[model samples]
Target: MKKFTVLELLSLELKEHNDLDLKCIAGRKGLARKIEVPNVNRPGLALSGFFESFAYNRIQIFGRGEHAYLKKLEKEKKSENIKKIFTFDIPCAIFTHNLMPTKDFLDAAEEAGCAVLQTSLPSANFTARILRVLNDIFAAREVVHGVLIEVFGIGVLLTGESGVGKSETALELIERGHRLVADDAVEIRCVGGNYLMGMGANKMLGHHMEIRGLGIINITHLFGVGSIRDEKRIELVVNLEIWDSNKQYDRLGAQKKTKEILGVRLPCVDIPIKPGRNIPILIETAAMNERLKQLGVHSSREFNEQVMRWLESENVRNIYFHNNSI
Candidate 1:
């Protein structure tokens, strides 16, 4: 994984919860410093001159309480505590609620070559937002050639060799009211807890699909906002392959298949594509069947049980009839 520098983080043009609203106040030279940890440090304990277990590697955040303490330390000429914190190689310091640090504090930060940043948001809000952003940046990601869609509230990813009609199938699904998430390329991220989330790889062409003959078409523009989604949790994966006359396909569906992505297991099904096969409807049914499985209702298992009962009943009737006839 490449290192994420403070400069890249500061340059992100995010909005709302992902927005840091950060502006560099001082210590520009420390902008190139690498942010090793995703978690942050409040330093409220360190502000009172308690230096034990100081989280210097984590980004330092100064909220209302810390700001007031800095003022008190300045009035008492206790710059020693402030200087003591700068002794460690801290990544950067952020002041929330647009609060300005005292001259002594800034001087210490400047002398130590630590970056100082300011945001208009309050401490709590900025902390939560920044944590969310950092978690995403540090998340494990992979790119796969496929099309992701939301079918009946379930995220289904369709993958196969190039020109296997993956995009066309997704387009048909969209026409049937399903939502397209990503076409052509999908970026999957593992965000802890064995969860796999997927989204479009290209930001500009996320909702657009490139049909073999029709060029690129925007699904959102043609099908309205409901026809596309920003991202979805991949629940199922369907691999479409060319139909083979000699190869045998699973008919009972008793054997469950799974696809592993980023250490997360996803239900997988293989559908062979041939002439005159309704692939889109098959995918829709697959999605609905998966939803049933999630609810602890397995159609394949139930069918197998029913068949076993019938066979046992038939064998008992045949034995009794044969003995009576003899």
Candidate 2:
């Protein structure tokens, strides 16, 4: 089910004023209805204002208000007389705060085809809660642009310029048994805390291969089942860019990099693309190495330490040999 945002619900236009009037106006005065009361409410000036704003009529007011007082009010309105007040049609009513209505009010509302429901909250609080919930129910949804790929059991987002070879690298990764979530355009949504998901556009889902020479081809039909994945959790980002010989690249994997998307931070790596350079192999290696690092193995750092230890031992051995020879 699509969740509506709070803003959307509040923006809806009010149509009617009171249940009876609304029913008469909508030509549904004879139909049974259901209505809910969120709090123990009093049918007075403040309530009248709220009812007017809601534009919905709830005649069987059920709440903590006294039944005898309501019966008296009904008597004042003339036993069978309806005010011809305009309101939106409501079928049922509920009394909250365990407030029961006078027998006359209940009978009158039943004759008018309206049911009432009473909730446990106070009227003021209930009104606020209802308004808030409605607001979220009616907002517009939007999509974003990015790339989502499944690499090493993690959602790896690859983002860069138009021709950064993201697709090509992704294709290579797929061939290496990894999965592809989305290419070129990715739909990113914040599902919740520290989590953002990427999905493919319907038109482009499962359709693949836009390489310079090969226009476009379907991935599932061609590569079979392993080439595509429905979805994956995003764990890292590999941004591809043209290699700059003048610019220094990180030889050691110690410099931590991250890219922020939708206010969430994701680990990021900048891979330079150049002619004759195998980006596919590099990306594959990066994914595997990322998995290793997650498992507490830092290959580059460990290798560096090993080299330093070997050098230290070699120096000591040479000194001993020279001393013995002298």
Candidate 3:
């Protein structure tokens, strides 16, 4: 990730609930200051001259309480502490609920080259939205050549070599009512160190797909808004390859295979492409099976267990019959 500055945060084209509604109030010179962490700190303690463990690196948040305290400090002519607060290299100061800072506080921030931002949202709401945005910006990401789609509510990443029919299969699935998350280049990110989130590498070209002879086609325009999604959690990975007559494939699905992306392991399946094979339906079935597994209903394991029980019963019946005949 490149340097994320206060200017970039202000320029983010967030919508609705995710909007920060932020604008520069003072210290415009420090808009290029890099934001190093995904966390924010309220400078209440630091403002009161308690500098023991001041987190000067994070973005400082000024809520109602903090704003009132600054007014009190200014009324008492105690501007020394206000100036001291900006001595450190703080990323920026954000005033929530459209609160304005005292003249002394703004002068101090401007003098020290620390950016001051104001938002119309309440402190709690702004905090939540900014945290969500920062987490995404700071997450570990990688770009892979594949197509991502949602089948039966499961997010599946279709991967393989070039021209192995990944995009074509996704097209078929989209035609069959599945939603396309991204086509061609999928940018996958590890969020919360637990799950993987995948989206289009470029937001401008997100829902566009390039078929062999069809060239570039917009999935949203052709299939409507219902057929496209901006992002999805990658729950399963399906690798499609040319049919190998000599290579063995998993016949029973008793052994589960996995693929690791950014330290997160996801369930993976290998599908060999050949004539007369319905790749789209196979992918749909795989997605459904994955959902069933998540519900603790593993089909392959249950089948193997039932087979073992039947063999044990047959052996016991044979032994009893032989003993009785003797």
Worst 10 residues of 2 by lDDT: 18-27
**Comparison by TM-score, 1 against 3, better one:** 3
Candidate 2 regions exceeding 4 Å error are 1-144, 202-206, 304-326
Q: How well is each residue in 12-94 modelled by candidate 1, as lDDT tens digits?
A: 98976688899999999899999989889999889898889999889999999999999999999999889999988888999
TM-score of 1: 0.90
lDDT of 3 by residue, 1-326 (tens): 54699999999999998889999989999999999899999999988899888999899999999999999998999988889889999999999999999999999989999899999999999999999999989999999999999999999999999999999999999999999999989999999999999999998876899999999999999999999989999999999999999999998999789999999999999999999999999999999999999999999999999999999999999999999999
Query: After aligning candidate 3 to the native by TM-score, how far in Å is the CA of 80 from where it should be?
Result: 2.1
Global lDDT of each model? 0.93, 0.59, 0.94
Model 1: which ten-residue window has the lowest total lDDT? 1-10
* Higher-scoring candidate on lDDT, 2 or 3: 3
Listed per model in order, the count of residue pairs whose N, CA or C atoms clash below 3 Å is 0, 35, 0
The per-residue C-alpha lDDT of model 2 at residue 201 equals 58
Deviation (Å) of 119 in candidate 1:
2.5
Put down candidate 2 lDDT per residue, 147-174, tens digits, no spaces.
Answer: 6778768778887888777777788778
Best by lDDT: 3
